[model samples]
Target: MNKGFYFERNLLALSRFDPALCSRLSGAETTRGRYRFIESRSGESIPALVDNSGAAHPLHSLVDPRREGKRLISTLGNEGFLIIFGLGGGFHIEAALEKTTIEGITVIDFDIHGVAELLSSREYIGIFNDPRFRLLVDPSAEALEQYILDRYKPVICGGISLLPLRTRADFSQGLFNQAGEAIKSAIDMVSADYSVQAYFGKRWFSNIIRNIAQAEQNTVPLAPVHSVAICAAGPSLDAQIPLLAERKNRPFIIAADTALPALISAGLTPDAVVSIDCQHISYYHFMAGLPEQTLLFLDLASPPLVASRSPRPYFFSGGHPLTRYISRYWRPIPEVDTSGANVTYAALSLAEYLCARNIELYGADFSYPRGTSYARGTYIRSLFENKQNRCIPLEALHSAFLYRTPLFKQGDENNSWYYETKPMAMYRLRLEEKVRSMKARIVVVPGMGAPIRLETNTGDNRTADTLRLFSSGKAAMGALEFLAQYRAGINALPLLQGPVYSFLTGLSKEETIIFTTLLPAAAALKRSAPELDTPELFDAVKKYCVGELEKLLGIWGMR
Candidate 1:
């Protein structure tokens, strides 16, 4: 453990934060066959790995590992989060930490034993001392996926990229490949969500302000129920409607927005309906008269007009980051997992939030059965029919709706053919994961789409007599006051005339939050204009977001 003064200083820094890790590293044992130090041309020693063939392979350059590391990092251009697949000597990780633009880095490597051996022989305290660095050893696909989902935030991180050490990846090819695919899966999932955020981030902030008046009421927690039925607008609902109508009163019925028309047509009444989409297209779902006694559960980011449609509408926070900030800072509300990206997913979450013990999913086909896009009496059919002309008949419109997107066919014609798409598949997978996590008897009725399997009988049913209230007291500041403070904060942000890093570092807490509201949009702008420098990007993002907010304030006449 004899290292240079600078290296010893790095270990001392790590010891201050993680004494346990330092003690473990001190006790670690490494053999020559496992790891050996190789001196560079600059007289700096680096660690190398020994292979099964008794050949030594340096983890870094014999000339200068630091130089090689910087070269590798330069290729990434600008990114907020970096995922390194190997922790060989920690040279690359140390280089990444030097970049101020990189907010965080996650290092994952296979074989914790081998990593321990390498740590024993090398001084990696420089890499370990960084507050932004995280280490994961011998992680499973599930563990890696969860870590990425939990740590990476597209709005805050801006962009994420993964880099793998070819030398080390080649040794544990199987594990590294699995890790790569898992990371890719998580990225794809996050990208889909980020796309949504990019489109509606500003709208979400505005919607929260508009919905604040509605959400100020005390949130009502649900009374425990023995059974609940979640109704979706999938094509299978055509047949399931009769059974649902028969047992409508047996279990509490929660219908998705799209399923409201189908359920109403079937002469059934649902106890509650959930809607999460912020787009105006969602208004069509409520074209039919809402049931008087039925409650409407709308995401705080939902279109403002949607809340006015129902007398007993309850506003809840969804996946929007702005809504999250409002929930934490202004007032808290019950949150529903809208990550499923569909109304049915939100409906199921509402049911879970209600503590339903026996939850049965109806019409959650999540596919096109026999090329039927929706149930028999959904709003689409009538809307298409009304819009049809001599050139385009009602049947033709229906056909076009079903054929709009190419679908993956599952099952044979003898049984039933179901069509699936990437979005549908992702939604089903997310729902399956949610069902497995919930400790309830969740059942998905046989449908025309891919089958959903959930782990049942975990025996963790919630039996609370009352639901937790989201808004316990009046907000510390009203919407107008909050908007005024936010406006001042946005206006006070440092101009992009200075260095990008300096401007970011100089931001006050309020300015930082305001800046967060701009990142998703900034990322979007950067994607479209890659030629823009960091300062130019920051300028554009700040100007665009602040201008938009200014317009909103002017329109509201609140300033």
Candidate 2:
């Protein structure tokens, strides 16, 4: 608003603060060596100091003492003003005046009365006379920040809010948070400046986190599991605990979070804990006091807050693409496709892969007919009302991704929704449908001898108690191991197998053949490029194969 002070830096941009405004308010009071404050009838008083002195202050090099003494000159910097809640003796003002090219500095304190006392001291005289600084001497955090916003709103708009809060009880512990948000919003509305980010010291640290699937899948040899059980904390697990305990030595035990506390109370410790929840709020039911050290099958993209607290955190990912990071870096486990499965489905997927033949579905009830499991750590008594829409309309999609009528959108309202479905009747109908489709021998051992008939394929599935837990006297490797063999076999005869490989990995049949044929000789490639050793070569091969296929297909031609 002054001749030199522009609201912006350039003609089109706001000057840092307002160089012209600093010069216009010079009609205060000053001397060549010592400055003094002259109180106007309108009750305006400011210390006169130097501006553009070409000399820095002895005590404070930022502002210099000026010959005229009405304004202290300083430069616009990462920090613009020194906010004194109580302007004491004008020492803050004099200290600030020993600089150059400053737009202005606002001082708020309760000691305007101290101005008279400061003028008597020659030490504070020269810097206090500068008009570039306005000393209000007000005393309120709200008032201080608000006044700063009102007067220097242009400069106060955006920056990392740094508040060294000093209080008796620290009630203002969250003040920086409240003020930072307001300032950021004001800055966005005012002008384009630095992109400001708000950080609260109380960002919240939890030794216990709710639900976030942090899975890290890699090509690790599958752990030997002669007999395997995917344990859930369902009421039915209570009925089967006796049987499970009797033969616990024979099987590898994996328990879902909820089942751990109870199962452990029964003198059972699981080898691993499987968590597959995107919802974090109600995850406490499973993880309230979980141990710090345990094998965790966690989602890779789960909130860092969840795994940060874990003693030894390994990751697994279910649906997130970023999950591969866990596999590439840390030891990982597979993220089983759990679209249509409940606890039983997840349990079975683990069991079958572990080579357990007599896989029994324990308490795989999809409905919460009663209000609760009649036990501790029950997550939900019934499904939320909105969840009805999930079952209401269903449409199938090709590939592993399912298109449920209402998708479980991230940050959606249903993330933590834990209400049960309509009733036992609806769940029974769907269960029958799924069981009939799965080509396996199934038996639903009813609790209390209730006749819960599960109609499976009308034939006996092979029952083999002899499970090969090792491959050639080594730890058994499952699907991932076979993938390498399949790839190498195709590479040896690309043209013949190209189409089939393409179709399998979602590429066209022709592309499959090309990819197969072009698969570079592994040992030869490594020898040609020293960097392409065992581990690196496999990934390189996968990458080159995918890239060639993608390029041939073109962006538009991709599936």
| TM-score, candidate number 1 | 0.85
Off by over 4 Å in 1: 1-8, 14-34, 51-55, 63-81, 90-105, 110-140, 150-161, 218-221, 455-474, 489-514, 523-535, 543-557
Model 2: lDDT to the true structure: 0.39
TM-scores, one per candidate: 0.85, 0.34
lDDT of 1 by residue, 356-421 (tens): 778889999888887778887788977886899999988899887777877788878777877888
- Name the top TM-score candidate: 1
| Stretches of model 2 off by over 4 angstroms after superposition | 1-220, 248-250, 286-288, 291-294, 305-314, 320-333, 377-420, 423-442, 448-453, 457-559
TM-score for candidate 2: 0.34
Error of 1 at 139 (Å): 4.2
Give candidate 2's total backbone clashes. 72
lDDT of 2 by residue, 19-53 (tens): 34234223222223332344433333433322355
